[model samples]
Target: MHAKRKTALAVGAMLAPVLALSLPASSASAHGYISNPPSRQAQCAAGTVSCGAITYEPQSVEGPKGLTSCSGGNSGFAELDDDSKGWAVTSVNRSQQFEWKLTARHSTSTWQYFVGGEKIAEFDDGGAQPGATVTHQVDFGNKTGQQKVLAVWNIADTANAFYACIDVNVG
Candidate 1:
């Protein structure tokens, strides 16, 4: 019995490091969403935009890079893609500031804003970790009328990004 106990202890000791090393790596910033101008997901949670699961986890709109969809190209957030859902449209000027509320701050590569499939603006973080919140100013140039803006938060050292869609009326 003593020999068996010693063997088990040794096995556990040897496995501890391996188990720790095998654990999944976590994102430096786990979750975040656009609040000002109110991203689709945020509005959903606020009850201003009717949605499904996104209403529960608005800050978790994570997906691979290059997704232009409002739902981050994720089916779980498909409600964001439905224009008929009466998403609250925020009125904005030609130049506007967008606020990102991060529950977990992660290393960031860049922040991009797109309108009608065109890149309107981008802010580079240069591989540095961001703060609890980030704000970006966007200029619409000459574009006007109702716009669906797709915002992307590119994570440094990772292939993933956080996406948000903000509907706005720009005059």
Candidate 2:
């Protein structure tokens, strides 16, 4: 029995690296949110807004790349999808640097920013995995007043994207 246990340990040690390599990079990429200007989730995570489950895992509010729901269709975090949440609106400019607190990194396709349903800026990562954090400075052009910035982080290896909805009063 001791010999058998030693053999099992030897085999298990050899497979650990291979197993870790095969896991999707985005699996732990789960916890991430807009931190600089603070999205609704960010606000909740920071205690500026009272939220339910989303306040606990703000970084996990992810959904498909093309979807518009802030909840990412996650019922547990459905409060993010509500437009009447009284989320604190951050004041920003026509050109502002948006920052994300990435708990894990993944190969990225592109980062898109939208205002009032129109694409304002898109940053292509060229299929490169990002570092611990990601930032994109955008120019809103002629847009102003209360606007919701839909930031989408498209994973290069997956068909899904991480979503962050930042409400800002553009000045």
Candidate 3:
């Protein structure tokens, strides 16, 4: 073989593995969603609520860090934005435990909970990577009756966050 051709082939082979290792993991495999209390996306994935693409990928509702939309402004998962979609309302006490089932752990900044456009609670992780599952006991305060709670997982390394909206009837 020509010397130049042989050198080029060797370089390509050496770079292949490095390139592969630098690629990001699949989004679906790198994110998470609320499981307990059953967030809207969770309902879709569990077939409790009929949905589109979100039905297969509940952990992928990611968007800019401060977005309030349940679908994370992702048009493909717009069904989550429809308050009239008949999402099952979970009945719970005033102080509730919210559980997040993480597909892959990620470095976190903070976990925020919102209701009626007001931040009800926030947990700071100090940019540490979380475990396979995370749970936060959030007090509903004076708020009660039917409410839509928005949960956001802020990633420390990125300017984006994962979102889940859970409908609940607090007793």
Candidate 4:
């Protein structure tokens, strides 16, 4: 029985790495989100607001490109679209530096920012792969008061994009 147990242990050890490699990567390893100024998902992940699955996987708010919703049209993260959730609003100057903390940095196409359904800023990455962290300095122009800034990271090779909505009071 001891010899049989030893053999089982050996087989288990040999299969461990293979099993790990064959398993799909978790959403936590999939992508990224706005960290600084804390987008809705970031707020969930940080426990600034109580939430559901998103609290564990803030970087997974990915969907097809050109989505304007905070949840990126993903039903699972619909809590992000709730305006009454009391999402913390950051106070910023006319120009604010938005930062993304990436988990799996994919090749990029463009970074876009929108306000009131109007495109306010866009930074073209030209299909380059970004580092773990990306920062964009967005100028709010004359826009002020409470605003929701939708940020999108379009993947160069994929038809999808990661989305984040930052709530802010532009000073």
Candidate 5:
């Protein structure tokens, strides 16, 4: 009985490190979609855009107080009227390539976009309504290990705030 107990304790200690190493890392960054598997046959456009999955994060704001009844004011207001921010982290092979598509929605308003904190694109939907989607394609460039990416949205201010940001990975 003493021998059996000693063996059990030794086994438990040996397994601890293996179990801990298998756990996933906790990070606030979002993961992007991977549309295609990494392969030598894969080619990027102008060596900038690559094949990869796309993910989206939605955001919104409150409508203006007195303008509640105003046209297009029903869907609340948009914060970051000029710029909103989002982030993501991805693990990639040294030679892997990827692209991204982003979108925004508002019934009575228009929204602009930025990547890596730089203005890259914009969309003007007529009103501040919903269901509006914008798309952009970007190349991951050359990267290894884990990489960080950012997306931002800009829209007019009102009552409710509106915004969406997403991150993805391609390897």
Candidate 6:
């Protein structure tokens, strides 16, 4: 009887560990999606114009980093204008209560931002090469209207070609 009880105890101990391992694990919640247009190819044209496919991808206000690139003869930088060949903007929110992600790729280049044809901010990652994505949160106060955000690569060392990915808005 004593030997039988010891074997039963050992079996219970092994089964206990197996039962614990079989339990399901928990995971973190995922962020919601942002509604934007599709991805389009774009190339830099004149100093104040860009031509190619145009689309937007909705992204999370807070989540994993996104990627964008422009290589070969295709440049991603473009001037912000009302004309057909320039950077375009779609207002996510007029009150500026949300945040968005902007990622770009350029061959030793920088980006310039404009609102309503006026310079608002400029970013270059301190002259880094091979390019990477940079996130920016914009605030437009409590006003309600369409605000345009333009990205222009200002690098002259080599031909600048790049594209931007604007993720979802965070409110």
State how far residue 161 of model 5 sits from its true place (Å).
4.7
Estimate TM-scores for all models: 0.87, 0.82, 0.87, 0.84, 0.28, 0.35
The candidate with the higher TM-score, 3 or 5, is: 3
- Model 1 lDDT tens row, 42-141: 8888988667888888888888998988877788888888888888898999999999999878789999999999999999999998888899989999
Residue range with the least summed lDDT across 10 consecutive positions in model 6:
58-67
Lowest-sum lDDT 10-residue window in model 1 = 24-33
| C-alpha lDDT of residue 123 in model 3 | 100
Off by over 4 Å in 1: 10-29
**Of models 4 and 5, which has the larger TM-score?**
4
- Candidate 3, pairs of clashing residues: none
Mind giving the per-residue lDDT tens digits that candidate 3 earns over 38-127? 999999999999999999989999999999999999999999999999999999999999999999788999999999999999999999
Ranking by lDDT: 3, 4, 1, 2, 6, 5
The runs of at least 3 residues in candidate 2 whose Cα sits more than 4 Å from the true structure, single-residue gaps closed, are 1-29
Q: Can you write out model 5's per-residue Cα lDDT over 78-165, one digit (the tens) per residue?
A: 2212121222234544333333222333333444333345444445555554433333444454433433333323334433332232
Runs with alpha carbons beyond 4 Å of true place in candidate 4: 1-29
On a 0 to 1 TM-score scale, where does candidate 3 land against the true structure?
0.87
Name the lDDT of candidate 2.
0.86
lDDT of 6 by residue, 69-113 (tens): 222122222221123433333446533322212343333344554
**Residue 61 lDDT (model 6):** 16
Model 6 vs. true fold: TM: 0.35
Query: Evaluated with lDDT, which candidate comes out highest?
Result: 3
